[model samples]
Target chain A: MQILIIAAIICLALSFFADRGKTIAGIKRGGVMLLRILPALLLVVFLVSIFIYLVPEKVITGYLGSNSGAMGIVAAALIGSVSLIPGFVAFPLAGILISKGVSYTVVAVFITSLMMVGTLTLPLEIKYFGRKAAIMRNVLSFFGAIIIGLLMGVFF
Target chain B: MWKILDNFFLLLRETIFFLPLMFLLIGLFDVWVPREKIERHIGYGSGLAGMFWVILLAVAQPGPLYGAFPVAYILYTKGASVRNIFIYLGAFSCMAIPMYAFEIGFLGVKFWFLRLIFSLLVFVSIGFIMERFVGEDFRVREGR
Candidate 1:
């Protein structure tokens, strides 16, 4: 809340000096874009809320920790690619998972894929970058997450 | 039912912080930033310096990956290279400065740094692969 306020003030101040017509047009355009993505955004938020109860730490630990191996890495990439948890929650949650015996690689892949690949935002991406480009970006990011996970697994 | 409602409100509270800002900035940049400037810096032929420039901007600029999409669209429409767009998105999603700090605090400096290196390495490599995969098809087929 505080951060957004400060940002709003800064933006208002910047526009005070910048062109008024352009600024108003920009804000209106922003609103249109918001409408476009609102459904997907709402769906993701709804899923996350339900997911909090459905996905327990024990469940995550079971699949992503201990003896879970290469398959764990793959699973982490897949799950994380779809999940859209915020950084504030994801980092701390990931920390706990790692401390509780989830391998660092799994945690890393989960975070990396969660950030890099966005299943929830696919519609918006397709609208902007076209279907082929959007799909390619996500798929490549999926593999990228796995490769990074493997590297982290080997090194750390 | 009440649980779902309560959860929805909580999610709205958080979304309020990010979504508006992301959209406002995207909208502002769309109108305010000139197309020519984007092309000069991050366009198809800008090469090494452009890659470095976008990565630097991506790391320094603070926002979620969603904020990046509109700006990237603007860049693409203005003729920014596919490679540069790939790098920009890669860096935007994976290399947040505050997130890095958080990672270090939670996971230790060595671990954070190692992950950071690997993330950048993979992003660049992916960028190249995407540039090839998307090819002229992206340029010809898509228009904003």
Candidate 2:
């Protein structure tokens, strides 16, 4: 995140040097863009927060840790799709689950779906990509997560 | 309510920090980068090369999934193919470099490498399938 800030600042400075008017115009466009998306962005944050509260890590670990068949993989994928856990937290939790005898395939589904799919962010995605593109991306990623999980089952 | 507020604030803090800078950079991209250059690299005609270029670009980008949206919109407007945009979003969502190091630490280098390969394959294929549905004419929904 810090790196991103530095990069943006550096680029902003360079762009300013190259063309002050365009740089200012770019910043204004950015502000307008943020305003345009603010409502949907807020809705996403609200939904995600409520979701995190409702589906605690304990509940997720319970479902994903013990069960080890098709049911478990489905559960993992579902939890992953709906929930928004940061990678810093999710990866370590996944490692713990693996240590507790959870299958790599199920963990794979959880991780893949968690990263690739986003239910809470749908409104924002639709705002940008439109309904068809947004919906297709999530749907495709959902299925892709399952397939990748199965492949992990075979290899690991 | 307090728990919700706490969580909301945490999420908001992160969003507030990233969105402005991301949007600014994307806005600058909008002004600076020419349409022909974007089209030459990732437009309908770019094909397999476009997919590879987007994947490389996505990995280098570091931010939350939401950060990718504005850039994707700009790219779409600039004539990047729907397939390349999808690949860019998918790769950005999962293949970020900072996340890569941590994933390897937890899941082992083998798992990291395999997942990376598998994800690229899956997302790229999905991108192809989506482009078939969405087509080159798809326009990103503009401001509400």
lDDT of 1 by residue, B1-144 (tens): 567667667765745455566567666666765444544554345578878877866765446677788878766776778888888899989886635534654566677788889999999988899888887877522334
Give the candidate number with the greatest DockQ: 2
Instruction: Please give the clash total of every predicted structure, in order.
Output: 0, 0
What DockQ does candidate 1 score? 0.35
Put down candidate 2 lDDT per residue, A1-156, tens digits, no spaces.
555567688989999999999999988976786687677667767776786678775665566654547888998899999988766556655765675577788998999999899999989999888888889899999989999999887887
Cα deviation at B27, candidate 2, in Å, is 25
lDDT: worst 10-residue window of model 2 chain A: A59-68
What TM-score against the true fold does each predicted structure earn? 0.66, 0.65
lDDT of each: 0.74, 0.76
Which candidate should be chosen as best, given lDDT against the real structure?
2
